[model samples]
Target: MSGQLYLGLDLGGTKIAAGVVSGSGKLFSLVRVATPAHGVRSDLRALFDAAQATLAAARIGWPKVKAVGVGVPGAVDPRTETVWAPNLPGWKSVPLRRLLERALGRPVFIEADRNVQAMAEAWLGAGKGASDLIFLTVGTGIGAGIISSGRVVSGSRRVGGAAGWIAVTDRWQPAFARLGSLEAQAAGPTMVRAARLALRTQKRGVLARLARADRKLTGETLVRAARQGDARARRILAEAGEHLGRGVASMVALLNPELVIIGGGLAEAGDWLLAPLRRAAKKWGQPLASRQVRIMRTRLGADIGVLGAARCAMLEMEREKKSNVDFPSNQAG
Candidate 1:
C-alpha cells in the first residue's frame, strides 16, 4: 500500500461500486449506487456518478489517481476493449474502456469480474501466497479467475476461467439454455429451483413448508432451512454440491491449481455444500491433481468485488509501467 492510489469500478447486475485503492492493495474508500433497471443510459450515468462520489468521499482529486480499472460481470476482450456481459442487456463489445476514459480522463482498463475477483484474492485474500490458484465465484452465474505462475490465465480469447460453462453432465436441460450445466445445477437461482422441486417428493420440512405456502424460496431461505437441520434443504444443497464438485474435479484435473477459493452467495452454505464438493473432487479429479489441491471459502465476503476492482487498476498501472508506457506521475497530495 505504499505506492500511488488508483480508482476501480465494479459493475454488477444489482449495483455499481467505485473505490480508491493503493498500489500495494489497500482500499481507501468506496461508494456504491444501485444499478438502474431502465437501460444502458441509466447504467452509464450511475457508473460515472459513483466514480465522482468515490473520489469525493476519499478526498482525492482525479489527478492524484494513477489509472482506472473496471470489472464487468462477463467476458472481456482487452485486445478489442469490448465486453460480452449477459447481465447487461443489449451489451456486447460496448467500448466500456473508452466510455470510462472519456468520462474520467484517465487510462481505464476493463476486465472480467472473475479475473478482478481473482486479482483481489491473489493480492491479499485467501490466495495471497498461492502461485497457482482459482477464484471460483458462484452467484448470478459461475465463473473463475485463474492465476497460474503468478499471472492471470486470460486465455487467447480472454475467457480462460469461464468455469460455469463446464458441462457437469451428459444431459442438457432447458435450464442450461442460458447458464452452463454446472451453474444451472449449482448456482443460487438453480439451487432455489431445486429446493422447490424437492418439495414435491419430500412432503414435510422447512423448505417444503415454505414452498407449500407459496412464499418466496430464495437462496437465503434454503441456507436457513438447511442450518435448522431440514433434511430436504440439506438434500437440495447436497445435490447442487454434487454438480459443483464435478466442476471442481474438472478444474483440478485440467489446471492443477494449488488452491480453489469459492466465493459468492452459495459459498455461504458452509460445510453443507462444501463437504460433498470436496468428496467429489477427490473421487473424480485426476489423482495427482486431487491429492494436492485445497478448497476453501472466501473470507473477504461482500468487499471482494470492490477490492478486486481496485486491485485490478493497481496491477494495470504496474503493467503499463513495465511496458514503458507513459505512467502518470502520482504527485503527493
Candidate 2:
C-alpha cells in the first residue's frame, strides 16, 4: 500500500481545511469550513464534516485512506493523546487523537500546527534542499519551526516553536508585558496598536490621516501608508522589523540554520520589513551567524498548513507500515 491516498486536516482559529492528497504531494479534493466558536466538540464536528466532504468529493472512503494527520494550534502530547489548545476555549487536555481516530475508524495522528508548516516548507517549500532551516511565522503570534538535517525538529514535548514567548524588552509593566514577546511587537495587531498610540498623541503623521475613526488598524493599511512615505507608519513598521530581526538573530545563534523563511500577514511589507530586520539582526545576531543565515519570505503562502498536514499523514503512514513489517503487530503501536 505504498503511496496510497491520505487525508489531512488543518484546524485553526478562523477555519478548518481538509484535503485528500496523493503520493506526489498533489491535492485531489479540498474543502474549507468556518471554525466552531463554541468548544472542542463543535470544532471537531466541523473538522470531521470537512474531511468527510473531501473524501466524498474525491470518490474515496475511509478504507482507502492509509492515514490521517491533523495540525492544531496548541500543545499536543502525542504519547498521552491530550491537547492543550487554549484558544478553543473549553479545549484543554482533550484526547484529540483518540477521538479523531475513533470517529474516522482509522489510524490518526496530530501535530502542532507550526511544526507541520515547518516540515512542509523544509520538505517541499522554499526550504527545500536545505539541511538546516527555520520557518518563522510573524502574524498574530510568532512561532518558529526548526529543521535540522533535513527533518523537522520536535522537542521533548513538541513545543519547539514558541518563539513569541521570548522576552525582548525589559522596561515593561503588566500592561506592557506582552511587548516582551517578539510577536506582540511585530505582528499585525501590534502595528494597529502603534497607530492608536500615535493617534492619541496627536502626532503629525500619515497614520492619523489614513486611519478612519471607525476602522481598525492593520498591517495592510500600515504598509500602504508607509509606502506612501507616512512618517508614523514607516517608523512603526521599521520598529517592528527591528524587533523581528532580533528574534531571528537569536534563533540563528541557537539553531545555526542555513535559511530563515518568514511568512504571515506582516511579511507583505516586503523590503520595507526586511531592510530593518536585516539591520537589527546584524546589529545583535553576532558576526558569523547573521552573516551565514539568509532570511526569505515563504513561497507557499496560506496553503502551507494544509500541505504540511498531508505530508505528515503520509510520513506517519509509511513509518507505521515499516514498523509493522519489522515487528509483530502488537509491538508496532
Candidate 3:
C-alpha cells in the first residue's frame, strides 16, 4: 500500500461520486450516491457519507488520505473558498472548502468541475503533452477550461472559462441572458427545445413522433434516434453542432490552442455531431489557426472529473511541500 493517497469527490446535481486515487492517477475504489435534491445540509451529509463508503471500499482509513479535492458543478472562487452552483439550490457563495475541511479533518481544495476535467486531460488524457489546450464540455450545460502555456487560465474573476456565455448571435433571447448565448443555442436542453419547436409546426419524422409521444425529451433520446437513421433527429443534432462549432471557431481564433478536447454527455452524439462541427469550424474559424488545431473527443470518459480532482490535490500537496522546504540559512557576522 502506498503511503500517500488522495480523496477526490465529484459533486453533481443528480449524484455524488467519490474515489480514492493514487498519485499516478489510478482509481482504487469508487462509490456513488444519489444527491439530495433539497436542503444544503442533507446534500453535504450525502457527500461525506459517500466519501466514507469509498474509503472503506478501498480498505483505507482517513489517516491515509493526504488531502482531499472536490470538483463541483458550479462557480468556485478559490480565493474565497466559496461556491455558487445553480443546480444545487441554496448553494450560493457557500463556504465549501471550509465546510469540507471541518468535516473531513484534513486539507481540502475545491475547483470548478470543468477546470478539473481540463486538468486531468492535460496531465493524463488526450491533451497530454500539449502546452496549450482547450477542454469544452457540452452536456446538459456548456462550459470550458483553458490551459495556456501549460497553466490553467482561471482569469481575474475566476470565471474566464465560462464559455457558455459566449454570444453567437446578433440578436439575444431572454433565455440567452440567463443560460448564456452559446449554451442557449447548443446545449442538451437547447437541442431538445429546438426539436420540440420544430415538431410544433411540421408533424413528421421520428423526432416529431417521439416529441408527441414522450412528454419529456432528452438529448440522449435524440442521439439514439439519429443513430437509427432519423432525419429530424439528425437535423436537430447538426443544427446544435453548427452552433457549438461557431463557438469553437471563435475560441480557436482567440486562443489558437494546439488541441481542443470535447467531453460531457452530449459528446456521445459522436460523428453525428462532430462531422457538422468540424465542417462549421473550417468554414468560420480563423484560417491559419483553425487549420492547425486538432479537436477530439475526451478519452477519460466518466472518470475525468474524479481523476482531475485527485490531480488538483496532488498539485496542492506539491505546492505546500515546496513552500515549506527548508534552505540552509547564512550566518550573520
> Cα lDDT of all candidates, in order?
0.81, 0.77, 0.83
Summarize candidate 3's per-residue lDDT along 73-101 as a digit string, tens digits: 77877567789876677888889889999
Model 2 clash tally? 0
- Per-residue lDDT for 136-249 in model 2, tens only? 877555678777776677677777777776667775646335324676677777788887788787845566566764276666778777888887888888898888888888
**Which candidate comes out best when scored by lDDT?**
3
Question: Total clashing residue pairs per candidate?
Answer: 1, 0, 0
User: Candidate 1 deviates by what RMSD?
Assistant: 4.4
Q: Return the candidate ranking by TM-score, descending.
A: 3, 1, 2
Q: What lDDT tens digits, residue by residue, belong to model 1 across residues 1-333?
A: 335888889888667888898876677888878878467778889999999999999888898888888888888775687888876677777888887788889988778888888888887798888889888987767899888877788877787788888999999798777777888888887887777677667778677666556577778778888998898789888888888899999998988999999987778889999999999989989999999999999988767887887777766666676875532111000
Angstrom error of the Cα, residue 279, model 2: value is 2.0
User: Which is the leading candidate under TM-score?
Assistant: 3
TM-score of each: 0.87, 0.83, 0.89
- Prediction 2 TM-score vs. true: 0.83
